[model samples]
Target: MSDKSAALFALTNSLQPVKRVWRQAATQIFANSGISMSLANLVVIVNRNAQGINQRDLAEEIGMNPGAMVRILDQGTEAEYLERRELSRDRRFKTICILPAGKKLADEIESSANKLRVQLMEDVSVEDIENATRVLRLLEARASNFLQEHIHEKK
Candidate 1:
């Protein structure tokens, strides 16, 4: 690999183990709550949307398949954390609404995530973190554009 490619590979490769570790930590954090990371993420998104979000948008936002989104909705609905209601203007679409319980759980999830992030970021300077975030964002945009040119919007 070229030096730039090697460096990018190192950066991306290092993240996988950290991600695995965080998943394990998150599992433990949510052990008794019966909520996985994806479930918690769904609740957080629902809580953020003031008008509620439809199933398709929810699936896209969560980067999950529509069927998996429905399954997650089913789990949340059964747990009484959220509900899906048919939109008034669009009868065919159902918007996901976060119940009071879901709102509370979302808050807890945010708190736990913040705590974990703080722990994980220990000894890392704020400036360095910001720089890394900026670089990552730039790379993400570049990657998206590359895909659009080569794969998505193919000529």
Candidate 2:
């Protein structure tokens, strides 16, 4: 294989273990907080945009389907973690707001995530981490551009 292909292969192989560690950590953290990973992620998004976020917008931002978002919202409502309030001017439009309980849970999840992140990077130097992040961002941008071009070409 060419040097570039060999490097890509090694990078792809490395990502599997990294992804596995993150998934395991997230599952454990969410379980301890009495929430699913999906719910915990949704709560974090809602809490960040606490002012007023439309359910549809939240779903789009999190790359979730509208139907799934509604189900997750329903579960959150049942758990008293979030509420959907009707807009006074437009009753048909409802805004999602994270409750105090949701904020508390978000905080806990963030704390646990941060600790896990630190643990994962404990052996890596700051400079190495920064370099890796830069390289990853560049790769992500290139991949995104390629996908967009390919998608448009197919249409």
Candidate 3:
């Protein structure tokens, strides 16, 4: 195989083991939470905002369909984790904000995630982590460009 293909093969092989390890740890940590992993992620997103954010903006940020966003919002509302308030300027736009309970849940989730990170990087040096983070950011930029180039725009 060419050098480029060989490098890609090695990189891909390395990712499989790392992915399995991290995902297994995450599954174990979240298994007893009574909430799906996806919902946990949504809770984090909702809690990231200071003044809350409009549902459409949230949907665009996550690339989710409007219907899917609405369903998640409804679920969050029913769970008393989020409150939707109408914007005064545009009453049609509803902003979703995390409740105090949701904020508390987010803190717990963050702690869990931090613990997992520490456990995963137990043997890795701090310098190595910094370097890896830089590389990951670069990879993210390249991947975004690649996807944009290959995927056709919606009409």
Quantify all predictions' global Cα lDDT against the true fold: 0.87, 0.86, 0.81
TM-score of 3: 0.78
Q: Which stretches of candidate 3 lie over 4 Å from their true place?
A: 12-21, 60-63, 149-155
Residue 50 lDDT in candidate 2: 60
Query: Model 2: how far is 39 from its true place, Å?
Result: 0.5
Candidate 3 lDDT over 1-155, as tens digits, reads 99999986887577779877876777667789787665666677789997998888888776688777787778778888888999999998899899998888878888898898898789999999998778767877998988887785632
lDDT of 1 by residue, 74-111 (tens): 98999888999998898999999999999999889878
Tell how far residue 14 is off in model 1, in angstroms: 3.2
Clash counts per candidate, in order, are 0, 0, 0
Greater-TM-score candidate between 1 and 3? 1
Worst 10 residues of 1 by lDDT: 26-35
Identify the leading candidate in terms of TM-score: 1
List the candidates ranked by TM-score, beginning with the highest.
1, 2, 3
RMSD of each: 1.9, 2.6, 3.0
Per residue, candidate 2 scores C-alpha lDDT tens digits across 69-127 of 88888989999889999989999888999999998988888888889889878999999
Mark the 10 consecutive residues where model 2 has the least summed lDDT. Answer: 29-38
Clashes of 3: 0
